[model samples]
Target: MAYTLGIDIGTYETKGILVDHAGAVVAQAARGHQMLVPRPGWAEHRPEEDWWGDFVFVCQTLLRESGVDPRAIKAVGCSAIGPCMLPVDVMGAPLMNGVLYGVDGRAEAEVRDLTDRIGEDVLIARCGNALTSQSVGPKILWLKRQRPELYAQTAHVLTSTSFLVQRLTGEVVIDHYTAANFAPLYDVQTQGWVDDLAEDILPLERLPRLMWSNEIAGEITGRAAAATGLAPGTPVTAGTIDAAAEALSVGVDRPGDMMMMYGSTIFIILRAAERVADRRIWYAPWLFEGEHGSMAGLATSGTLTRWFRDQLARDLDPAEAFRQLATEAAASPPGANGLLLLPYFSGERTPLHDVHAKGAFFGLNLTQTRGDMYRALIEGIAYGTRHVMETFADLGQRPARLRAVGGGTNNRLWLQATSDITGIDQEVCDKTTGASYGDAFLAALAIGAVRRADIAAWNPAAETVAATPDPVYEKGYALFRRLYQQTRDIAVELP
Candidate 1:
């Protein structure tokens, strides 16, 4: 009657699950949080409020609602939307709000400074990534150069999951997957920190110890036990970046398996044998050993849909609004009747590393309705995926198949559009996201309840929907490919 818990903190919400050896989410809970936007192109989250507070709720709620024995919980694994930079004091108190993932663009200047200081080739060769807002190093440089007082007082810099682990186990350590984004700061080739990358960056002592994501870092302390309502000594592993963990949750265990997560920001991760270093695509070691992967990113996927809903659907409930939009969008023919959109509302990433890239609509005839615009947005995101998918293929790293997960797949029409545009057969995982399932699965593996040697024995949720591309989509996707360059001029013309 033992159990495991997988808790995940996302950009806008937190979700957790309590499950036994068989992988059924016996009890689940979630809490929503507001993303703070103080200025244009900046996103922040109160680490105490959004990151750990929601976790407190999920932990307590799942424990109570499941009626599971607190002591019987073999382990707790956590995952978070990350590469978040929040410098903390010695007591694990946040010095300021966390830089909210890649969505926040406050560190553009720092990015340039890093690329100039370290040079792109050294960064790419060493950390397997180049400077983008996604890198933790630039954020650190921002704090150091901009807010010297905070940087000087800073006791440690941590990502989201490691922050939680510090609060839980009274330990400060980051996983390699999360630390990989600390490019130019972490010497991945040497498997250690590179203290000499930048003279103006945060002090080297601030970085946390790095470990593989699955290695048990420490046991939850008594203080964390009281807050989370769990046995104090329960083992907690060094978790991973939310996307990598989500990739794991969707059965991207072995090499060549790809997980395309359709969530707030669409993330594509594919496993490979050796590091296929590409500046266009991020490369990182997978959670467990003998696995490495490359990542493709889209800044706004579900964010675009959410934006449309907030601005256009003031009269509709969330469910009804998405349902109506999906229905109408589905009714529109492929390519939304010759419409194309570049979904770079927050700026494009992956395949094109432009931070100033803007978004626009092409072939938007006056005859097109709001519904057509909505479907055009959907198609734009699908085209974005195809752009990166083609890059992977060009590198001879194309995945054999794709497993789709997260909230975007909840809308069958969106998933269908994505599958059609990419021409990849999509398998929709049941409603589970992030590292939660992978947390449970990893816990299962740890205790020998489920053997990792045979993945078939560790079954994930049954596929609820399957999408296959139609041949008619071929010419449409080909046309969609040209829209990025064709519309780039129009997008910049707006402002």
Candidate 2:
């Protein structure tokens, strides 16, 4: 029987899955790694260890555990957290640690400089995006300015998935979806690199060749075959960012369908009927051709929950800390006992796009317990998600459905709170294996083993988290907005 392989490099871990032609998950494996935060606004990942190394382990382990012949895998697909900025040499060796996504705000000056030089209106008209922390163009310019010596040696700029694809297939290519995050460097109308904007940062030649997500980038090379257990010449698709793949895994196709990914960050993607030209949110060509996508994200979400576990709940065993926190949080009444957190620990993205935004707890009282604080953190993230949803409504592009995916979906309180706060029902699918599962499905589609619509059958909506109205939460959501607005100036003054 034919099979496929899917791997995803995430912020904190890498996961891989093997699936048969019918979409049954045959086996899975994962590797954990650290995400480095060298400075307050900087985040980096060791591409060699965290990305490529993890990928090799996942590939070999998945093959061994499943007892499936590597040759039986018809195609391979991969997705990762992006669009990261990694400079690599001509041989595709990473020059330095990969600069991560919106959470890394090291390019603040570059963002302003590019926006001023190119003119924001022109950029929006040509590329359908504004210069922000998420834009790869600014990150590239930051490298040239801050580390000129290293930039001089750089041959190509790549995101996480592109780096993996090159490692696997000896091809340097990026999907249109991730390319859209490159901002002024990629032209939405032409669906190609904007030479003028890109040349200013790096020569157009340094950019990866663009392709659709489902297109075959190249066959696995002999070198990749040796490192990975897979046979040489295995077909590989031009995989996309993790959120896109996660969306696909849950059948988030067709206009108005949306995916609310609760992972390291809170990422929301809405399938738009047409390009919704809004500066508050990002617009990208969808994974497939003839489709459009609008996206928004918070810089931190599950990461905050993890932080709470590590710092505050460290007395408990690592495995028991999260459970204890969740138990305590459930006991805390809604509104988190009058506590409120901004959920901008790294920075804020979308709508605000304020890299200087600081996380804070308002209305803290001595009487409050750890559970109240934990619940406040979850509520804060839910409020942040609601803010993004309201932004979509403001643009007249509100989604028809909201599908929740990722590890955070396991947190019943968080998912239910998000729905209650956002007033949108969330559909949870049976398989929340996330992007890896989506990668396998995408690979199957590329190899003609599965039709595009078959994802619905492979993973159906298992349950719904309906909005629960609460007057207390209604007041809390209102206060959440005001707190951010009032504290904006204070955040700006924080050194």
Candidate 3:
């Protein structure tokens, strides 16, 4: 019997899964890691502490629990957070901790400088994106400007995937979907370096080779094999971001199907053949080869809820607190008695794309209870999601249904709230956050044991929940939309 392994180095955790050829997850193990914030806005992960150590632990745990022979595994695949910049030396040692996604605002000066160098309109015309903090080009430029000496010694710049691939296969490679985020550094049209863009910052000679996710990067080295309990010389695929792989696992095969990943941040990945560029919405690659793919997202989703539950309601036990809060939230009819939450604790991304936007509690009343507040918090995020969805339709791509994945979908209230706000049905996966399941499926196809057409047969049985918008609630949501739109300026102005 053949088996495949899938691993994800997530923002807050490292997870590894062992699956047979049939898409059945035979064994799974996970370990949580810390997210270091040295300053107010900077987020960093020590490569040795978070990436390597946690991955070794996950591999050992999964192998021990599964009781399967390591020799039987055919291929290994990985998914990780996207577009993070990691500088590696010739021996492939990390020079510094990776700079995280656009949400991490430490590179504001670099963003401003680059925007001035390459006009925003010309950038949009060439690469289909204005330089947001999300792109690696700005972060690379930041390192060059701030630490010129370190930048000079840098041999190659790699993302989370490329760093891991270098360790496992001794190859420096990147997947196109993630590499495209390094805009202007890479020419999306020509699929190579953009010498004309950001030339002052750094030489673009060493960008990792861009390959499709299914392409084989290289076999695991003997050293990498011993570190994890895998057989030597195992082939590893050039995989993708956790959200993109999660979408594949939930069966986002066609353009109409949207993936709503309720992870550390909210990611909406919609597949489209045409380039859809809106300054408010992030328009980038979405894991398609030789075709245009787009995604839009918010900076916070599950993390904000976690912060609220942790800092605000620490005294209550998790189940007891969530049960109490969810029940209270469910009791309040839609609109939450005129209370609304901005959910911009970490600033807003997607449709709004304003880094200065601060979270707010709008229309709060002295009569409102904690229940109303909790409901508003959840609804605020749902509203943020709705804004992105509305943008997709505005650009001529509309998702008929959202396949809910990640730990957030497990909450019935959150799932139902997603349906209620969108006025569309949601298919909550039997196993929410099933990237491994998706990886297993892809691995099986990569080995030719399964056909691409048979994915529907392997899809986990999902409970379809439909939302019928109430006239009263619809009227209230209209006000919710108006509040954000009308007072966006005020929200951005807050300290």
Candidate 4:
């Protein structure tokens, strides 16, 4: 039977799946990795260890556990956290740790400089994005200025998935969806790389060859085969960012369908009927040709929960901490007994685009229990999500259908709170394997084994988190917004 292999490199873990032609998962494997924060406002990952290493381990594990012949895997697809900036040498070796996505704010100065030099209106018109923490061009400029030696030695700049695909096929390439994140470096109108906007970022030659997400980039080389336990010459498609793949996995194909990914961050992607030229949200060419996508995300979500567990819930076992916390949180009422939180531990992304934003637990009282605090934390994230959705609404691009995916969906409190605050029903798919499952489906599409519409059949929605409005949430959300605004000056001034 024909099969496909899908693997995704996430912020905290790497997951892989083996799937048969009928969309049933034959086997699955995963490996965990860390998102290194060497310094404040910076995030990095060791490409060799965290990315390729986890990939190799997961792929081999899937093959061994499934006992499926490597040759039976007809095609391969990959997705990863992005758009990361990893400059590699001519031999395709990383010059330094990969700079992570918008969560890493090391290039704030560069972002400002570029925006001031080239007007935001021009940037929005040409690049379809504003120079925020998410833009790769500023990060690249930061590298050129801060680390000239490495920049001098750099051959090509690649994102996480580009690095992975290159390691597999020996063909350096990137997908249009991921490439769009390289604002000022990529022109949306032409759908190609351009060095004309702030030419000092890098020569256009240093960028990868762009392809659509489902296009076959190249075949696996013998060297890659040896490392991955796959047959030599196996076709691999040009993969995309993890969130995009996750969106596709849940049947988010048509315009107005949004995927609310509750992973390391709460990433939201809405397929748009046409290009959305708004700085408040991101715009990129969709996986398929002639389609458009708009995106928004919080700086922290699941990561914040992990931090709370690690710091406050130290008595609980690591494995059971989240579950225990969820139980405790559920006991608290809708308003979290008058507690509010700002989930800006890593700064804010989208809408606000404020890198200096601070996380806080406002209105804390001695009477409030740990459960109340936990509930407030989850509610804060929900409020942030509602803020994003409202922005889309103001732009006349609100989602008609919202599908929730990723690990956070397992947290009933978090899921219900998001719906309660946002007042949007969230459809949960049967398979929450997320990007890896989406990768498998995309692999099938690349090989003509499946069509885009087949995703609904592969992973049908099993349930919906219905919205239940409460007056408490209405007051809390208002306070949530006001707390951020009133404290913004003090927050940014702090060291």
Model 4 pairs whose backbones collide? none
lDDT of 1: 0.81
CA lDDT, every prediction?
0.81, 0.93, 0.77, 0.95
Task: Give candidates' CA RMSD values in order.
Answer: 2.1, 0.9, 2.1, 0.6
Better candidate by TM-score, 1 or 4: 4
Predicted candidate 4 versus true structure: per-residue lDDT over 1-495, tens digit per residue: 889999999999999999987789999999999999998878889999999999999999998998999999999999999999999999999999999999999999999999999999999999999999999999999999999999999999999999999999999999999999999999999999988889889999999999999999999999999998999989999999999999999999999999999999999999999999999999999999999999999999999998999999999999999999999998999899999999999999988999999999988889999999999999999999999999999999988999999999999989999998999999999999999999999999999999889998999999999999999999999999999999999988887
lDDT of 2 by residue, 296-409 (tens): 999999899989888888888997787788899999999988999999999899989999999988898899999999999999999999899999999998888889999999
lDDT of 3 at 131: 77
Model 1, span 1-495: residue lDDT tens: 888888888777888988888776688888998778797667788999898999999999998898888998998888888889999888889999988777777788989977987789988888888888788888888888888898877999998898998999998898887888887787767767787777557667788888877677799899999998989999888887788877877778777889888888899999887888878898877776556789988888988888899998778888589988887787788768777777888877788876667777778788897788898899788888888999999999978767887877778778877777776777655544556777776656655567664333444546634456676567657776676666666655564
Ranked by TM-score, top first: 4, 2, 1, 3
- Report the number of the highest-TM-score candidate: 4
Error of 4 at 458 (Å): 0.5
Compare candidates 2 and 4 on lDDT and give the better one: 4
Write out the backbone clash pairs for model 2.
Answer: none
| Clash statistics: count for each candidate | 0, 0, 1, 0
Ranking by lDDT: 4, 2, 1, 3
TM-score against native, each model = 0.94, 0.99, 0.94, 0.99
